[model samples]
Target: MEGDGPGGTGPVHVPFGYIVASEKWRGSQLAQGMQGKIKLVFEDDLTSDFYLSNRSCILYVTEADLVAGNGYRKRLVRIRNSSNLQGIVVVEKTQMSEQYFPALQKFTVLDLGMVLLPVTSQMEASCLIVQLVQEQSKEPSKNPFLKKKRALLPLESCLLRTVQQIPGVGKVKAPLLLQKFPSIQQLSNASIPELAQVVGQAVAQQIHTFFTWSG
Candidate 1:
């Protein structure tokens, strides 16, 4: 991370909810549009257009870069290979740059596995950058990229819980009943007399009647 203090140029932490933009971005239209929308700290040492966070970097490819061809790709490849950080390539895709955008998209996204975001102009890229930074600033669990918590698994505790739901089976008796039967199939097939050995005659009858009850 780069320093945010006025002209200090020293290494510093990137505060949450702020952007560390490249010094080259100063005076650009993108920088102008970003004013008040997101807090930016410019640094000359930055390798990309902006560092959304320590884990993510942004590369801006303007209409001029598309006209230049293949050169921007080399820059992208270098950044992708050299850094472990997530790369987001923001490409300007207005009418003039439309033709070149497809090929550029293939190279950056399909080939490199880096994220590609299309914007009509620098202003749109600025807005998208703000959204990206906002997403990064929030708790990781709430981030869109993090997978939603997995569906509940059928764990042993879950099995014991299901067993305890049987009428007359409390927590203690649930495990004891499962110890002999091992599975629902084996437990259900057990006669009341067979189940009596573990849970005693009364609960044995209740357990047997619970699974076998048709009404």
Candidate 2:
């Protein structure tokens, strides 16, 4: 559980690591968001007792590395993959409040062999950035309602959105199908003819069910 995991092992290195890249920002687009160099600090260990239900693979951050003159620190969580890939860390926490540490810009899992499972979008990540900034500004204990507002959709929404984005969906019909079938798994289970009934034979029949094929 200690050094056996990826990355390595040490006092500060156990569950922590320095940010090598800001996944949310890259090149010119990244520059627009943060004027200074963007670096983050993250955690990759579990805090409490272990269980099958508990997400053994998760990441957190205690602080961030910020550049001077840049009004904001690179306060974002990130995850890393084996193929030199990096992404934002998406963990469900009761409430993350660590604004006290100005130097702590970001909190996430270290670049270990952890793959960031896709469940939400960059838009949701943007909303989280706003919430994290606000939470850091005040005593986290005082605010509870913040938890209710869902910044990111669950796996169901993710699948639904992806399905709707197909070329022929346009805008109107996409929402219609998404509203009816909330998840890819569910949609996949449905018969092709059933989908054709909703989106019509030509379009629906032509669309291959990625989920069914994979399943």
Candidate 3:
């Protein structure tokens, strides 16, 4: 929550869980206007200053901020994981590129959904922020760590571990398979055709044979 910033803006006192606007967004009307209304702070360089819980909700006004370079990208990744926040990067539609897509994927893997907004200006970005704030207010916030911890229930953990051991199944694919079949027992009980429907034929056959041998 602490970072370097210029003086004279005075101490910004926000209620606990208040949104902290990034210093980079000082130019935007929304940021400027909200200065006195909300508890806002200005930080040197951060993924996004306006966050619900740490990095739970971040707003990037430009794609350049995200695709700046390896150092910036790594910092973003760290923030994303540490806060498990929902990230929104605003840019023109034409600005999308293959180079940044991999970084987006990494964000997704951490369960931090990174959204790309093809917005033209701060006006549109501001509107989007209002909408998001409203929506976020409507829903109860869930802790990302608790959600991950819940997934480690004895039975569920064992099932996930067993499923990951299947040939051609890795961390990502194993989760997909679990979505289709909730338990390892059910997955093992499934027919080749049923398993194929979820994970394709070759891998399905491997899973079926592995379970068969174990049985």
- Top lDDT prediction, candidate number: 1
Question: Residue pairs in steric clash, candidate 1?
Answer: none
TM-score of 3: 0.43
Top candidate by TM-score: 1
Q: Evaluate model 2: give its TM-score.
A: 0.34
Clashing pairs in 2: 43-60, 60-108, 61-107, 61-108, 64-104, 64-105, 75-105
lDDT of 1 by residue, 96-183 (tens): 9988877886576446645566788888878877766765545444222122133111123333554675779988887777678655
Whichever of 2 and 3 has more lDDT, that candidate is 3
Candidate 2 at residue 113, lDDT?
16
Superposed on all Cα atoms, the candidates' RMSDs to the truth, in angstroms, are: 19.4, 15.2, 11.3
Query: How many backbone clashes does every candidate have?
Result: 0, 7, 0
| Candidate 2, position 185, lDDT | 37
lDDT of 2 at 65: 21
lDDT of 2 by residue, 125-195 (tens): 43433333333234433222123222122222223334554546655675566555543434445677877
Cα-based lDDT at residue 92, candidate 2: 23
Models 1 onward score TM values of: 0.60, 0.34, 0.43
TM-score ranking from best to worst? 1, 3, 2
Displacement of the residue 88 alpha carbon in candidate 3, Å? 4.9
User: By descending lDDT, how would the candidates be arranged?
Assistant: 1, 3, 2
- As for candidate 3, its clashing pairs are none
Q: Least accurate stretch of 10 residues (summed lDDT) in model 2?
A: 48-57
